[model samples]
Target: MNDLTINTAIQTALPATFLGRHLIDGNWVEGAETFQRVSPSHDTVVSVSAKGDAAVTADAIAAARKAFDAGVWSRISAKERSAVLLKVADLIEANVERIAVQETLESGKPISQALGEVAGAADLWRYAASLARTSHGDSHNSLGADMLGVVVKDPIGVVSIITPWNFPFWILSQKLPFALAAGCTVVVKPSEMTPSSTVMMGELLIEAGLPAGVCNIVLGHGEPVGSVMSTHADVDMVTFTGSTAVGKMITEASAGTLKKVALELGGKNPQVIMPDADLENAADAATFGIYFNVGQCCNSSSRIIVHESIAEGFVARVVALSRKVKFGDPMDPDTQVGAIVTAEHQTKIDGYVKEAVAAGAKLELGGGALSVEGLGPQFYQPTVISNVTPDMPIAREEVFGPVLTVLTFKTLEEAIALTNDSEYGLSAGIWSNDIHTCLEYARHAKAGTVWTNTWMDGYPELAFGGVKQSGQGREIGRYGYDEFLEVKSLVMRVGRDSRKPWVKASA
Candidate 1:
């Protein structure tokens, strides 16, 4: 193993184990016990975080509940909330390097990508700030001469935000600021595997002058921490981004309260390549889509449904490109692919690839663990599999890794059929130069967001979420901001002629 290091690292050697504490109400407190985070890339302990449990989860929820009920933040002026959000965005940008490094260490993604996720998240906060100023309801003035109706949007009280490990900071930004913009107080539970950055975000919230108890962070696993957040009576809503299985558990747990649940779950997102499409761009996008974030993205185009006429050529191009994708240390600027989040996850990724190969899917490029010269055995080769059938587990399941599966279709109808065959409807894309083909595919695709000529191009203004089992509710758009709010209709009789009471009581 080489001892070389990138400038992005705060120090050449591993820094002190970051002490992560729970942020409850306005205070940072220690948990019942501390858990250590060993860097998946470097193979060393990088953090020691407070391990919150049911009681701690309850405490954070109580804080958010009190803050919402108190109306300190819930009833604040939109302009004021916007100001705080803007400040938080500014602070986010200022602390990018600090947050990104820790995230890279814990999450095992490239530092460059981590930098982008943290830096890019500022735009989400900025956009949410804009939403705070613009979000409104409708007014129906055409009701009648004496009657008027007003629709008002109010913040759903305490919200529970559960974020995933992959793209942790980015996903949290997708939900948190929007909820705040909508005037909801929240308790956050980041994945136990990647909780440090959320703690850092809590610090920024304090610096941005967010009111005490408006946002609280509790670090721990699903059982007690996440359960309480989802099921608590005082919690008005739950917004979760993770696997569909866990999403189901939260759904069942939240049923008792019937609290609104917004889940951005897993996906088996597909990209269709038409015979008339730009082969080069499609191949390039396919490669990037599968490799970005090491394919640990909910929007990852894990499978490509290619037309039979172009299948062989496209597969060859993607295979050649996959071989060229640099897979190594995440801290290095040039490394395109990096370590998997854990040995277990890496094993899971390889298992899927192996299973596919065993199940008659042909391995086109790579399909197993890769050893970085100086790093631990936590990296996987950029894998590509062709001749994948619609029935294969790899083609249907969420193999959240740098692996791509290829399936073929002779007709557009067949392509659409293959794309919609899965339970996941998070995202799907088509590469076609023909306008009709692209438009037709877009309209017919069951996914929430369809890319006519691109893949996974997201914007804060464009709402994102999935249909079917990929999960419900939206995030990161006007729709996302609306998720944290409730609508109320007010009907008022104008001119107080002591308007129409159905019956006059005891004249």
Candidate 2:
């Protein structure tokens, strides 16, 4: 690793020259146009990224298709592919600091959190590597003595992956590594707002011996680039992580080609605090759920559904805890909350809070924009709102920021009702000591992932996804790998006297 130190003063340490290139067909190529990437913390241009148009996106798709059809990557042995993925994981571990710094600079997440996400990304790669070697087909002995039957899992060809701005590298790891492990070629489009880290990822994959045309990166807005990737006939699968609205768009666009789509979209996750629960611990868990990653996570517990008996005290505890959260320079290791992704996003979060307050939700704490000493006005104070009704927009919609809305439930049935009442069924949590109550609620909640006494806990071995409008299909674990694969069954006659009476009967 180079002994390059990032300047803590300006927070602009990345090389200006490494920015405006797209990785296509295993080569760094300049784009037809370029756009400046402004840091959310300081509002300064951090890098100029390549702007991929429809034609450029088509080129990337063609490259991936060629690689897949050529069988350069798809026909390779599973163990060999696993070896390559393991090397990629090794490379990522070696450059954790560098990648984390770039991620923090581009996405405005705290440096400590960024480092943790980078390490998580490396672990995801290693897990995908393990899956690659272990994944296998099946043979049936029950087919009878005259015939043999086999079922095989094969790669689904070129995959187009679109990742979001928040947790850029981490989300990409959830999709890309597994796709590659399954022997699929890929064309990726990271969010234009934070493409720097992903662009560097393309370089790192190449260094780790990913074959040319096997992995391609296109940097641009969703307009021509994302649209092309979704509708392109050559692309076999599209896995996206972002808003539910955009996930719907991708699904509609993919209808033209009937491509396989796995969408990990938005959420209005609820944290239900039962009357028997520990108020202090529940408050702390709620704070972590809605504030971590600046509450930009899809599975963020934005809604706090508390039993009426404990609602008031729990709300007060959450408000007091919100005050202790530090918001400042993203590069600082002590900063718990960092700047929002952009001024536009900050405005949207503010608008939600304002609308909620106007609609009779009481603002218990932090309700407006925050001004850090030297950082620009992109940070918003961690906010807590109480007296939120189920019908209120703040309670129903996704705020996508460090804003938590508190609602009270009179009974266990009411709590479960409130939890299931959403267009999103991504994630939900129950804070209770009663095993039977927790289990009942978990079974009834409409979410894909339910945490009994925890929030946002995940493992690569377990499947993750959402139900209803939260989008379709699963990610991570064997399910995530299966998303990039297709199953095929084969049958063959084995008996020497297998030429039976079919022709005689026809005659």
Clashing pairs in 2: none
Candidate 1 lDDT over residue span 247-269, tens digit each: 99999999998999999898999
Model-by-model lDDT, in order?
A: 0.90, 0.89
lDDT of 2 by residue, 1-507 (tens): 011111233343543534758999999989778998788886678878889999999999999999999999999999889999999899898888988887887888888999999988888999999999999899998977888889999999999999999988999999999999999999999999889888878878998899999999999999999999999999999999999999999999999889999999989999999988977788899999999998888989999999898888888888777777767788888777888998888899999999989999898888888767667778888889998988989999998999999999988899999999999999999999999999999999999999989888899998899999898999999988899999999988886755657657554
Instruction: Report the poorest 10 consecutive residues by lDDT, candidate 2.
Output: 1-10
| Highest lDDT model number | 1
Per-prediction CA RMSD (Å): 2.7, 4.2
Could you tally the backbone clashes for each prediction? 0, 0
Superpose all Cα atoms of candidate 2 onto the true structure and report the RMSD in Å to 1 decimal. 4.2
After superposition, the stretches of candidate 1 with alpha carbons farther than 4 Å from their true spots are: 1-11, 496-501, 504-507
lDDT of 1: 0.90
Model 2 residue 295 CA deviation in Å:
1.2
Candidate 1 residue 202 C-alpha distance from true site, Å: 0.6
